[model samples]
Target: MTATRPLLDPAAARRRYVRVCVLFWLPLGLTIAPLVLLLTQRGLGLAAVAGLTAVHSLTAAALELPTGGLSDVLGRRAVLAAAGLLNLAALTLLALGTTPWPLALGMALMGAGRALSSGPAEAWYVDTVQVHGGPGADLRTGLARGSSATSAALAAGTLLGGALPWLLRLGPDLGAATSGRVLPLSVPLLLGAAVYVAFVLHALTALPEPPRPPATLRGVLRGVPGTVLDGLRLGGRDAVVRRVLLSAAAAGGALAALELLTPGRAAALTGASESGAVLFAGLACAGFVCAGLGSHLAPLTARVAGSGERAVLLALGAGACGLLLLGAAPTATGRFSVLLAATGYGLVYLGLGAAGPNQNDALHHRVSGAVRATALSVQSLALQLAGALAGLAVGLLPPGRLPWLLGGAALLSAALLWCRRAGHLAPPDVSSPAEAVRPGVRTDAGEGQRLL
Candidate 1:
């Protein structure tokens, strides 16, 4: 006789949640400090980098829904394993390849891995929690913990990744001998690949997929398309989900604008290529730390503002102000102005971080487990699609005007979150009221569901 799986206890759920957060983010974070500088160091131009980024986003956008449905049908654990394998290949190519085409190929692989990984881990967490703790299980705290863990991992990995190249440079002979062609910059990506290897092994052993009908190729093909259609329909039928997705797209545009502009700005401020890379790395680390702080404070922000929608609006407003400050910094002449720009950078991450868990919490309440991963993938697709457009457009604009344009777009996004009348529309088409409203708690549609 086969042994039965145990129901997920609170302690077991917490361990899995933290595992998913660390494994998913740590590999990506390891590359953040060196990625752009490494490309430029390999003779890629600004336009080329923009093109590569757009390609990555487009690739991820194309695969998002299909991969989500694959996870929904096949299994989250299987899909996550595939993602890890792909990352191993992608990161190897990225670390070793020198030319643009080679790097582009690596980017393509990375995008596919990203799409596969996006929702499966989170879906697993939600499903496992609901199975043990019931549909009315408190998700905001768990989601926040996952979000904060991701940010914290990024912060620590970025700090370490940034400092490694500098330290390696100090011992030039040994560094060249060990790292070969790509030198200090490529070291982090190589290390990231090793992390992916470990991530795959850990995921295979640690995560237990919920039992479903046995998966067949025919089932996957038939089931996935139907799942995609249902997920798309859900977005159309629900006004809140539609608004949340649009807001995600706008946030994507803002993020693209920042990622494109900021490193170049850092390079200008520091006046040395190597020094700039290190400085940008440090700043990126600081930004991620600030983001973690924002996520940790999200529930408090919601409670204080009286609604998730209002909190989202307030956070976006802060982001817009930060962008405006960044835009203004160039006109001023002082080291203090540079410091102001840095502060603005941190603020943007803070605002974006605060908005994420709130938006996701709203989305989770509006949907059912049957299409959970697909729905999350739809949200991710919106972000990637807008980011692809923003990457191309932001690269074309003069640096001075970029932040203002992005800030305006963010302001418009915040406007969409405003609901004139706070009332219910019969709690959507969710399977149970507990799915939309937390157990015994009553919530208004416009204000969003209260999780805390």
Candidate 2:
């Protein structure tokens, strides 16, 4: 008789998840600081850059659900590896291409990669932990650690990405060899592509899942849409899930407003766009650091609040208060305004960071492993779509406290959604017979009914 491979313990699985999370996010971070500057250096105008960004957003939004469903049908390892490969190609094209078409294609590919990666890793982590520790696994600690790793990777990558070009210029003119086509700004993107190679390797080798039934093309085509439909129906059927989706949208809107308004505020304060850009970059790094700190503190927050539901409510309320403070910042006199704005900025990220793991822990408990990735994809899509709308509205609104106030109000309303006890919500229906009867599995029908 053939022996089966041993399943990983929850502790080992958590460490692996955190490592993969860092690897996955760090590459994207490496490109974030230098992408815009690289495009402009390659001769694209600001208008063109904006259009390309929109293309990325639209492509990701369009593909998010489909890719997530594909992950469900095809398995997490395959989809994640594919995403890494696509990102590698996208980064290469972005680094090398000077023309509009190549750049646009690169952005589209990047968006596709983003959609493909949205939820598989987290889903894999949850599934693995549950398999080892039963349905009552300590998911929040692992989730919090993963979140913290992501933020730390982004913060490190952003600083390294921003500093690489300047450091290169201090040494030698490497761009001369490529006749200025390979500008210093493009170096970060090239390095990002290299990172993706490692990411792909890690995904394929490290993330082993239980054997899925052999999937043919016809099977995949049929399965993906069904899974996607099931995920869409979840929000309508589950009250807790519905609330989570709404809260994600509100958070996205608040973030959109903050990102749209902050740079201009910084520029107005500094009297030069260039200096303001520098300050904004620094502030972005600080925000990520604050987010990491909050994520690290997530378990303690839950302990203090007495439950994950109350923790989310408190954290989001804090975020809403941060937005209100930002709105009030404009009214403050002199240097006090700067101090107030900075404090609010940190608070916004910190609150969001603390809320994310707790919110996701609730989500995982309420979802079956079969549709877990798809549910996460739905959450991501809600955030992206709401952010797009909020960005448009904030852009159109006249410069004042109205935009910030609106964001705060939306977040506050979302916070209030969690004010009621979890027992009041209806339990989610079981997704499948396999999930319902699986050994050591706790279906949402039992625990989800008790905890929101």
Model 2: CA > 4 A from native: 1-4, 331-333, 424-452
Cα-based TM-score, every candidate = 0.87, 0.94
lDDT of 2 by residue, 1-452 (tens): 01145556788888888888888889888887899999998889999999999989999999999999999888888999999998899999999898999999999999999999999999888888887766556789999999999999999989999999989888778778888778888888889899888888888877777777889999999999988897888777666778889999999999999899988878877778998899899888898898898889898998999888898899899899999999988643369888999899998999899988988887877777788899899999999999999999999999899999999998999889989755532322334613411212233655433352
Tens-digit lDDT track of model 1 for 305-421:
887777777777777777777877774436897888888888888888887877777777666677888888988988888876887788777768665556556755564565432
Q: By TM-score, how accurate is candidate 1? A: 0.87
lDDT values for all models: 0.76, 0.85
The candidate 2 region of ten consecutive residues with least summed lDDT is 433-442
Model 1: CA > 4 A from native: 1-3, 39-51, 98-102, 172-182, 267-276, 398-402, 419-452
- Residue-pair clashes per prediction, in order, are 0, 0
Give the range where candidate 1 is weakest over 10 consecutive residues by summed lDDT: 432-441
If candidate 2 were superposed on the true structure by all CA atoms, what would the RMSD be?
A: 3.3
In lDDT terms, which candidate is top? 2
